[model samples]
Target chain A: MHQKRRKRADERRAEILAAAESVFAERGYRAGSLAAIAEAVGISKQTLLHHFPTKEHLLVAVLERRDLHNLGIVADMGLTIEAMARLVDLNLDWRGLVHSYTVLSAESVAEDHPAHEFFTTRYDRSRHALADSLRAQHGDRLPGGLTPDQAAPLIIAVNDGLQLQWLLNSRDVAIGELFRAFLATVVKGEPPAST
Target chain B: MHQKRRKRADERRAEILAAAESVFAERGYRAGSLAAIAEAVGISKQTLLHHFPTKEHLLVAVLERRDLHNLGIVADMGLTIEAMARLVDLNLDWRGLVHSYTVLSAESVAEDHPAHEFFTTRYDRSRHALADSLRAQHGDRLPGGLTPDQAAPLIIAVNDGLQLQWLLNSRDVAIGELFRAFLATVVKGEPPAST
Candidate 1:
């Protein structure tokens, strides 16, 4: 009975996170409220507070729950250009995750914003990790002669920039393909013969 | 007396827009408040309402006020790879425009967000214009081989994606230099020789 009760709590928490994700994505952390998120989950504000305690806590939880599958792939595969292409392909199916991540990350750029530190550290770490991975695999310089440190941020920028485009206009763009095209030139192989 | 009053009103409206830009950049449109913006400019909500009349009107005023110098450059130079490089150089000095644009464009991706149509049209026109420019200059295929429409969005993605990085940490990266490095491969020339 205790195990079943614990599972129920976990399920409720997951549902709350989903509600919070959409709320934060649509309204943003500062404007999105507990009352609205609670109402979405069909619960009272008191019960929602019992689960999250505060708005900041809920914001943190929603951010932490972002699908880290692509990052994990980067870690495992060592960020080979092809690996990035494959990873982007996966993001196509995860629209909710993409919208929330893109919206929240941009909103987090302001100083003192709830996720500001998280994003600052996250970008720092991602850049460092990518540079390290490229250096480890390609040895200090990528195929095109740029150093790992220099190339790392460009790669990150492309990923993020493409997300905004794809989020706004999914019907026309093939982000994975576009990313692959960008990566080919950076990674120092023959540019693809055709689009 | 009428002339003096007209000039003062224009100045006051510009001030309100600047305050609104920072407020929206920090808290986002839905979350950002008129009262805070009014207070920042040392006025009451009633006075602000008199000037703009509604929150959406204020949002429109702020969005419209964003510097379009970059787009203007693109138009004059016909999307040549070099024109983009020069364009990015200008954005580095326009940090206020950069922050508000980066934040709000991402937020506008949500369904029915007020600026959603604006961004959608902007990207569509930019991509079309770029493609037309590239095709006219290069004759159906860029030196690197991708058509202009194909490369247009990628260029945009890098510009935006790099803004996030720079907005977060301007200390380390030179977005213009990084952009040039990416453009080298896409535009099909020798990559920069050194970091």
Candidate 2:
């Protein structure tokens, strides 16, 4: 009976999150209210509070859900440069997911935000994972002095920097092409001497 | 008489914007309120509204002030890849400026945001200027097929992407090194060959 109750509670939480995401995306994070989100989910604000306690809590849950989904994709897949590239491509394909969260995450920088630690830690974990992957694949091919730690940040930085441009004007830019160039640069183990 | 009134009005407007920026930075966009900003400026909400009609207008004014400052920097500078690199370096050096504006800009994506057009146009102008600079510097040096338009977005993307990591874990990452590496790759003008 306890397990069944927990399952139902979890399902309800997921429903709330889905509704919140839609509302947040449409209204932008700041304009979105707990009452509106609860309304969308056909729940009372009191019930929403029972589940999330605060809007920040709900926002963090949404981000966590996304992180879990992305991490799962990376974890379950085979390790290869191609796989890494594909993972990034998947992120690009879900531009809306990236766009919505990025906007919210940026807005989450205040002293009281619940998602602050989550975003900070999320970035750290992503850097470590991507770096670890690079170390594993190209342990033998690093340029004269480059280490996995150095390469990892570069990789992460490029991935992130690309997303900003994608958000601004995905209409004109090919995110995949840029990622491919970055991957090739990494594989070659040196900055290209010339284009 | 007109000049005196306009001068006082501009001074008041600047004062309000300074207060608003502080409040917005402290509280995040959504949570920050016009009343709070007015209080910070030691003015009534009526006075604040007299200077700037709405919260969105005040926010856009703050962003415009920053962009104008940046544009001033860009204008006094000559066209060259080296100048572009220096501009990137300058931006990273004033990392707080980038962090504050980016955090704020992300929150300014609401459908009715007064700053939405400003942010969009600012991005467009920056990309165009950077692309033009690259083309001027390396017109013939680019790999046979790559154009500045193609390369400019990639550079902008990397710069923006690195900001997310920088904002998250400033201690573990050196944004400058990664940017330098990227600039080197761009200056070289060739796509990295596959291993």
Best by lDDT: 1
Show pairs that collide, candidate 2: A160-B161, A161-B157, A161-B161, A162-B157, A194-B188, A194-B190, A195-B188, A195-B189, A195-B190
List, residue by residue over A14-93, the lDDT tens digit for candidate 1.
99999998887777677788999999999999999988988889888877766365667767876677787887888798
Clashes of each: 0, 9
DockQ for each of the predicted structures, in order?
0.70, 0.40
**DockQ, prediction 1:** 0.70
Q: What is the TM-score of chain A alone in each candidate?
A: 0.92, 0.79
| Residue-wise C-alpha lDDT for candidate 2, range B112-136, written one tens digit per residue | 5556677667777777987787788
Q: Write the per-residue lDDT of candidate 1 for residues B1-195, one digit (tens) a residue.
A: 999999999999999999998888777788889999999999999999999999888887777666365557767876688888987888788787788899889888987898898888787777788777777877775666566777788888889999998998888778988888777756664556576
Lowest lDDT block of 10, candidate 2 chain A: A186-195
CA deviation > 4 Å runs, candidate 2: A1-7, A27-31, A92-95, A140-147, A186-195, B1-6, B92-96, B109-112, B140-146, B189-195
Error of 2 at B103 (Å): 2.2
Which residues of candidate 1, in runs, are more than 4 Å off?
A: A75-78, B71-79
TM-score of each candidate structure, all chains considered together: 0.91, 0.83
